[model samples]
Target: MPTKKLGVYPELLTSIEKARQLIIPEDRIRVLNPLIEYIQSKIDQGQEINLNFICTHNSRRSQFSQIWAQTAADYFGIPANCYSGGVEITAFNERAVASIKRSGFKVSAKGDANPVYYVFHSDDKEAITAFSKLFNDPINKGSQFAAVITCSHADENCPFIPGTEKRIPVRYEDPKEFDNTSEESAKYDERSLQIASEMFYVFSNVKMPA
Candidate 1:
């Protein structure tokens, strides 16, 4: 509900806006507008919007999506809460942490085996609680939520996510192939940056209140 503003530079906003127009389809753009308008109206009326990103694993894609979306929303002066979860429980992967750090986020170690993490960004520290069990955590509880599926498997298996106003399928390819590769670090960083850029596109074109 709090309209937190990051106040990015005007030139950056212009570039993000341009990038948004290129990434999203016109039809998909139309589909997103209704929800976007509603969200902005709620913000205008002092309500916070929430988005939940889901994948098969909590490590790479969804984690990046959630953090970047929150960052983008804040950068755009949108009142939003972004959370992430997975169908199977796994701690945030080490590759993700390293990549996130490279992208300018501060991370606090949450443990050893399946240790969680506190991904710190700007004025927001999203309580990025991850669960191995589906829908078994506090991150899934909210009145205003958008269910964003980042993987094909979870999206197919769990077609309907309870408590979400919109179940959006925005799938991303798994970056696990880079595992054990020579370019592991660079690959993870690439994946993280891709997610971040896509999320920036999402908020840039999202309808603001009229």
Candidate 2:
């Protein structure tokens, strides 16, 4: 399938290109298959694809998944709406935000605590509005969506997510472990790129309807 030419900032394009080249291990591919199947099912049904990435804090992993998933879908010309949420409100981590900026996204924030961030990847597309809130927050799609658990905590603790059509676990290590350490920036960037690469893999596998 042909991809849409995105007018994203050059740096982001570079990042995306880099992500596209990274190899996804077979183990990881196995873990990501459910998400791929869910997207394909949506395409087969000619329905909108809604994915809500859930983490314990809605601060890091889930945020990364949300941004990268949406970006990848756009790149592949797949119609998908991605969102992120948590069991509790904690705010999108500044470290995670910085990592995306380093990877080539334009971001702006509003409010003080738990600010809403507008992340723009392409000039023509609307900014992805990001913030930390409950999985059932008003801003997220309430039903007919995939609940992507991005952390073991949320995946294991939150047994049931109301209104979800499927629950898929695509857990990632928390870069929070390196917070305040010298590896903070590097670790966050690593996780962000990993998520970006994986998301690109998922969308790249999706076949558009004939």
Best by TM-score: 2
Give the alpha-carbon lDDT of every model: 0.68, 0.95
lDDT of 1 at 50: 77
The TM-score obtained by model 1 is: 0.77
Candidate 1 local Cα displacement, residue 3, angstroms: 9.4
Query: lDDT winner among the candidates?
Result: 2
* TM-score of every model versus the real structure: 0.77, 0.98
Model 2 TM-score relative to the real fold? 0.98
lDDT of 2 by residue, 130-192 (tens): 999999999999999999999999999999999999999999999999999999999999999
Question: Model 1, 178-200: lDDT tens per residue?
Answer: 88899888788766666666776
* Candidate 1 error regions (>4 Å): 1-47, 123-133
